[model samples]
Target chain A: MDLAILGAGAVGRSVADLADDYGHRVVALADSTHAAVAEEGIEADAALGRKEAGDPLGSHEPEAVFDAPYDALVEATPTTLGDAEPGFSHVERALADDRHVVLANKGPVAERYDELRELEAASAGSVRFEATVGGAIPVLSTIEDCTPESVTAVRGVLNGTANFILTRMAAEGLDYDHVLAEAQDLGVAEADPTFDVDGTDAALKFVILANVLGGGGFSLADATVDGIQDVPGSALELASEDGRTIRLIGEATREGVRVGPRLVPENGALAVTGTRNIVQIETREAGSLHNSGRGAGGPETATAVLADVGRLD
Target chain B: MDLAILGAGAVGRSVADLADDYGHRVVALADSTHAAVAEEGIEADAALGRKEAGDPLGSHEPEAVFDAPYDALVEATPTTLGDAEPGFSHVERALADDRHVVLANKGPVAERYDELRELEAASAGSVRFEATVGGAIPVLSTIEDCTPESVTAVRGVLNGTANFILTRMAAEGLDYDHVLAEAQDLGVAEADPTFDVDGTDAALKFVILANVLGGGGFSLADATVDGIQDVPGSALELASEDGRTIRLIGEATREGVRVGPRLVPENGALAVTGTRNIVQIETREAGSLHNSGRGAGGPETATAVLADVGRLD
Candidate 1:
């Protein structure tokens, strides 16, 4: 497969670096402004080195990547809300060109799914976003294999930042601010951790899950979300006493999506510690299936994008 | 797809009972001795009712199912080791007839995987055994989606009986024998609990996983097996004291398969309670992915078999 990766972030660069290992070639690599396009294959190291040195990846503009001959366009740009612009437009441009799309960006899938599906239906290409939910844990693909109709619901701890804070607070008997600061210090939580800590990130993932289950007609605005911002140390201590712990869990069914700090069994599968994330998929026939792992990371998310790419044709 | 189910067990009967719900037809149903065949569709309830009443499922001989018109042969018979007979021959017959095979039986998949693959390679039909490893958990399909080549290792607690016993022992400070007896009384463990408690059952499942990961060449004999029978209640107490618990954990890599009582964090994903099962798939690029759910049940396993049938073009 020939990949045109749009974004020079960790996931995009990793995809460029490892595409060859997966028997794929990167034909185009782009950031916000500059792009490096090669018919055979891009000099990935040089482009990435230039990216590291704070210069243009190549002489071409980012839009030039669309002209490159590529089998799939990997959308790894930073996610945006509502209109899901740039990412949504990138997908629109890819599908318009009859090129398959593999998304590492969550915005289009979460906030503009029906439009995305409409675009997919009109185009010869298909859109896949396994990286948009649960990182490389294969949540969407698992639901796909079981057929989304048979899946009753999906629930889990999807935000590693919030989960890290909650897990640390419970283990160390610290308050939210203290743990959040500690997580920031460890680089586990972003400098601006609004989305991760405020439930928008997890909600977006669950909204995507809801769309997959219900088949379009879902977006972030429909979800009911509650973050762990106010979950105090005493709350964790109380939950611990009751053999439970509070996790910022998200649940998505066909009818709705909800993300909140919920109590889960302390020694149960849902109370995963540290930066780990777990997704519990409830099926009509198979009961509940829980998939857990690192739900965030450049390489981890890149593997999911490549896996989605592998699925296309 | 028209199904010819060759077993009157819980899984087979449930497959027949629910085939209509999944938009499929059961044209033939059989046990070890009797068969029911109808080109249109069999009265599944009648055949199952007869079996429940301590009578033959049908009037025809079991071999007659082979002559029935069906798209797939569902092997839901009891799992047997060594030659994996009857089931192995049945699968061979189906593949020879260019009919897809969905297996609930672990024998052919775990012990005779090479022969099964050889038969599949020569025939137009494809063999899928999703129910063989994790019952309804979608373990094999997840690995298939991830591409087994990229999956480095698979680890988890696979046997429900063993897990139930271990959980009760830890919770109630009960000995292995007491828990085993309780499990048998509760119908969680079979009358002959040797396989479940001695790790033979979990080993069979892991051997099947190894075959999937390595593309054949594994059996129960290739695995290092240890059961929970010798794991005293004192061991559970000690593990609990350290915020850990003993589980009948199995790990399957391309190199080998191992199943034994191992300590996992008390609140870890692997410490699933009661009769639940979990599988941790370690991918080279994606890190570890854990899937937990009901490992065994009639309807649950039937869902997996039907899901496999759904995948057969």
Candidate 2:
């Protein structure tokens, strides 16, 4: 498959390095500021070298990637919440050109699901966003195999940043602030961590799951969100004494989507530690299914993007 | 789609009840002694009634199902090792007739994977065996979505009967015989439980998983098998003190397939209790993926069969 990657971040670079192993060719590469396009495959090694040396990838504008002949567009741009601009426009343009899309960007899928479906209906291509929810866990594709109507509910620990903080606080008996500082030092938490710490990231993932499971027309505004910022060390100690752990769980059901910190049996499937994520699905016929794995990382998320590319019909 | 069912057991009856909901028309059903065929679709409720009343389901011979016109064949017969007869011949005949096969019987898949693949290559239809391994867990389909080449290894708790016995022994501080008797009384184990207690059941499932993940040409003869029959209660108590639990794990790697009792952290992903099953897959780029669900029961296995039927092109 010929590919055009629409971002130059860690995930985009990882995809470039691994695409060859999956029998894919990178024909275009673009960042917000520059773009590189080739009729044949792009010079992936040179482009990666320039980016690593702190040089601009290319001189062409981002829109120039569309002019290249490619079978699919890999949208790996960083996500932005409301209207999901830039990323949304990139997806619409690609779909309109009869090109399939594999997305690592959460903004377009979670925030503009219904509109994207409209574009898919009008275009010759389709879109897949497995990386938007649970990095390489295959959560969305699992749901696809079972079909949405058979599923009753989906619950999971969707955000690794919040999970890391809570796991540390519970295991080390540290307060939230101390643990947040430690996480930031370890690069597990960002300098501005509101999106993860305040539960917005999990909510966005929950909304995306709901859409994939045939519960479309929902967005972050529809979710009842909560975070783990106010959890006390005393509560963690008490829960530990009782052989339980607290995890920030995001759930989607027919009623609505919700995100909050909940108590789970310490030995149960949902009580994963560190930066791991778990998704538990309830179906009327197949009973309950649980999937867990690394929820965030450059190579892990890019692997999901590659898997989606392989899924294209 | 038109279907031909070749069993009158619990799984077959369950499939009959659920097939309509999946948009399938059952054109034939057969037991060891009798068979039923309807061109338009069988009367599932009536056929089930006759079977429940100890009456023959129909006047036709068991071989009569092959003559019926059908698009796919559902092989739900009991499994036999060694030559894997009757079941093996049944599957061969179906594939030879250019019909797809969905198997609940493990004999053809675990024992004759290479032969079955040859038949599939020469046939116009495909073969799906989701019900042969992890019941309703979708283990095979999950590997299909990720592609077997990218997978490094697959590890899982693939049997319910042995898992139930081990879980009971650990929780109640009872010995193996006592728990085995309890499980038998509760209908969780067969009166003659050698296949499950001796790990043959898990070994069969491991062989099937290995074949589905592209590690074909393997069978029970190639596996290093061990059962939980000799597990002592004192060991469980000691392990509990150290916050660990023992689970009967079946693993399939490029080297070989093996089943044995292994220690897992009590709070880890593999430490599932009761009759539940879990499969963990390791990949080169995607990290580790874990899937868990109900791995047994008539309705659950039938649900997996129905899901496979829905997946047919």
The most accurate candidate by DockQ is 2
The 10 consecutive residues of candidate 2 chain A with the worst lDDT sum are: A141-150
Candidate 1, residues A1-80, lDDT tens digits: the string is 99999999989998998788778999999999899999999999999999889988988999999999998999999999
Q: Model 1's DockQ? A: 0.61
Cα lDDT of model 2 by residue, B51-118, tens digit: 78999898789899998999889999999998888999999999999999999999989999999899
Superposed model 2: Cα runs more than 4 Å off: none
Task: Quote model 1's TM-score.
Answer: 0.94
The best candidate in terms of TM-score: 2
How much TM-score does chain B earn in each model? 0.99, 0.98
TM-score of each: 0.94, 0.95
Candidate 2 TM-score over all chains jointly? 0.95
Report the C-alpha displacement of residue B286, candidate 2, in angstroms: 1.8
